[model samples]
Target chain A: MTALLQVEQLEVVYQRAITAVQGISLVVQPNQIVALLGTNGAGKSTTLRAISGFLGLDDARVTEGAVRFKGERIETLSPQDITRRGIVLVPERDKVFPNLTVAENLIANAPRGMTLAERRRLHELVHQYFPKLAELKGREAGYLSGGERQMLAIAGAIVCGPALLLVDELSLGLAPVAVEELTRRLVEIRRELGIAILLVEQSAAVALEIADHGYVLENGRVVLDGDGPRLKSHPDIQEFYLGGSGERRSYRTVKQYRRSRRWYG
Target chain B: MQLYVNIAVLASIYALIACGYVLIYRVSRVLNLAHGELMMLGSYLLLTTASLFTGHPYLAFAAAALLALVVGALVYLFLLRRMTGEMVLAAVLTTVALGILLRGVMVLIWSASQQYPREALGWANPAIALPGGARISTFALLLILSTAAVYLSLFVFLRFSRWGIRMRAAGQNPLLAAQRGISLHGVYALAWGLSTFTGGLAGMLLAMDSGLDGTMVVIGLKAFPAALVGGLDSLVGALLGSLIIAAAEIFLIHHVDPLLSDVVPFLVLIAMLVIRPWGLLGTKEELDRV
Candidate 1:
């Protein structure tokens, strides 16, 4: 089976100097939910932006590697062109047009050449997944709670009729309950639409709960990758990411200890 | 009554031109400082078309208007489009340079002589006497009506239309708009096109009312103060700002020295800046962005 997206040895450099992502690679098969887990500045968002064609905005470029969407080379395409090709991103910050109402935000994102009936159907599909958005249709997106904004961002992306959805920091600044609800909704959206999702997340637990496959990134490289259940049982993931160990250790001892990362060849 | 009529006419002219500034600035956050020159270009196009069309004044006028829209969009496509993702100041400076270049080009093409588009189009600007003995020229009345129509249509477009909402979305957050598949270049081009179209209409009408000359550029410059005073992003603010600026200019010209006419709008602008830098209806956060 062909992958929806393939990033082969991707390296992104900012302003032709600082390397943000150093030859990291990952893939998402059609209709699969793939999680890219990393902490702040681990090049997770940079990788996502590289795939989404937003590198140019930050004076960054794909120095070495290619981003392929459904067997087509799309590394040099513009954001709009990339989106038109059916990959939509729900950005981490300033995700929604704040001044626009919820309905206007959704209306603002119809893919090129979409008919009115298709638009209405997509709108209904979005509202069906995020019913709270239907109630907040008249409210300015700026006034929405953190979770509602995320929902609207996703809904807006959905309206674009994307084959792949890139979600950056899905659970950022949201309550646990809200995050769980959103994750469930994301699963439902994926199940119904049969669309692939490349989810960038810092919370491994949240990502692994819904992710079909997961990759752990550290210092701009993929340290480990596996199917969901196997990744969940990995000791390094539990120790560093999930905080599974209960026994208290001295600060000095903990600071001195370093766990060897099992790098994937 | 005559004072009120004069105020209304001047206010309408400023409002029409000021909305051009508001439209471009609101969308791309770059002030098209070349707006006045572009406005003058529209009048000149009308002059050429008038002679070309010969007996058909309406055709000449429509041709000029359509040409202005195309020119506006082309300006974005060829010139301003390159400035995207660059610093906002650089884009604004590009417009400034464009204005100077356009001014020079217009002089070479049309010569320095004042040209009457009204005469070229074979139309008479007869003043219509009002009930209170105030007279308004035919084009000036048209200017008032056109301003109202443009503003009403723009308000409706921005509020209810899908493309209009997309424009607003693009203005507020260009990155997200692009992520959502709305083209930034397309939105910016539309803004430039609409802005130039309206500015061109004001120029065409003003030239018909009063002969077109280099001084028309000053009128365009004067409208900038109106847009700034109302908040550069708000159309309603542009209307209110134009009224305030026109009222100040007309009343000061009547009550004070006539020489104060050119300085009055700038004075109002300075006062507005000192008192409320964001303008009356403009978003408070926009001041920092500027």
Candidate 2:
């Protein structure tokens, strides 16, 4: 089977000068949860935006790369056009329409060929995933807690019936318990909807918790990639990202070790 | 009682026109100063269509209304579309320039004369006697009814319809709205079209009530303070603001000075700005963001 989304040698430059993302390549297979883990400024968000057609908003463009969705190039399309083609991004912040109520937020998304009955069924389905949202349907999204806001954001994207969902920083401002719950829900959503997800996050633990395959990005380049369990157990990932302890090593030693390590991809 | 009648009539007029300002401001965050000129153009269109369909006033009104809708959408599609990514101040200035251009073009086309649209449409403005012994023109009564209808329908449309929710979504977070597959330009164009259609309704009714002239634009300008006092983005605020300004203007005209009629709304607007700059119902965050 073909991949749902493929980003090849994607280099994004902002405002004609600063290169935000440099030669990043990734793919999201159908029904797969692909984790993109990186620290801030590692170009994780930039790569997601590039795939979701939001690069133009920040005066950024794919200077040397291609984003293919269902075997069609989409990096040059408008955000709306890209979204209509089933690549939806749940952005890091301002994820929910603040003034709109939870129900309105769900309804506000552009319906992706869903009949009224089907849309209603999907609404009920979303409510099933997040019962707290159903309880606060009339409350404005601005007043929702961070977790609830995240739920609404995901629900909004789900309503679009996207083939590939790009979620940026899902655990950014949520409590650990909230993050765990949301990550569990993400797994359920992927299984039920059978859609691919490219999950971009700073928290390796939260992302790799359910990701089928994972890639580690450093300075806008993929430094390592493997199956979820393999990446989780990798010495470098365990020490740096998962924060697993190593034999009382000094920071300088770890830095030297990091510099010496090289990928054979 | 007469003062109340006058205030209600004036309030109705301001509310109808102010909604146009609110609609455009809410969706695009751009103050359309050209709305007054567009309103006047709607009245002039009525005149042209009326003369064209000499024996059919309803057809003329419908044709003129349709033209107004098209003109408003075209303004966004052609002129204001270029100003989309610019600073808010620059966009406002573009509208100011557009208003002047429209004014000059209108004068060159229709001439700067007081033309009676009622006469052009073969209709007469008759004074209706109220139960409380207040005399209001028939068209003033229609204005009140039309204002009620417009506000009711707009409230329903914005609160319930999917497109209306989309418009609100677009206004609140344009980038996110675009990310969700909403065409921002389509939403903006729809807002402009609706704003002008309602403004044109106000202009047509007022022109039918009184003879059309250059001063109609001033009346449009005066109504903008109502929009500001109510909040630039809230339709409910617009209605309440119009009532407040209308009451102040009528009371000042009768009790203080006749000349205060023109200045009272602005004075109230300034007072509102000082006390509550975001207007009564407006979200406080909107001012800071804008």
Interface Cα RMSD, each model: 0.8, 1.0
What TM-score results for chain B in every one of the models? Answer: 0.99, 0.98
Tell me, by DockQ, which candidate is best: 1
CAPRI verdict on model 1? high
| Candidate 1 Cα outliers beyond 4 Å, as residue runs | A249-259, A263-265
Report the C-alpha lDDT of model 1 over B37-117, residue by residue, as the tens digit: 999999999999999999999999999999999999999999999999889889999999999999999999999799999
Best by lDDT: 1
- lDDT tens readout by residue for model 2, A1-265: 7778888999999999999888888888899999999888989999988888888778888999899999999988988999999989999999999989999999998866778898888888899999999999999999989999999999999988888899999989789999999888888989998878899988998888899999888877888899999999988888888878846788898787567444523
Give the TM-score comparing model 1 with the true structure, all chains together. 0.97
| Per-residue lDDT of model 2, residues B189-271, tens digit only | 99999999989989999999988987899888988999999888899999999999999999999998998888999999999
| Cα lDDT for residue A208, candidate 2 | 86
Could you give the C-alpha RMSD of every candidate to the true structure, in order shown? 1.5, 1.6
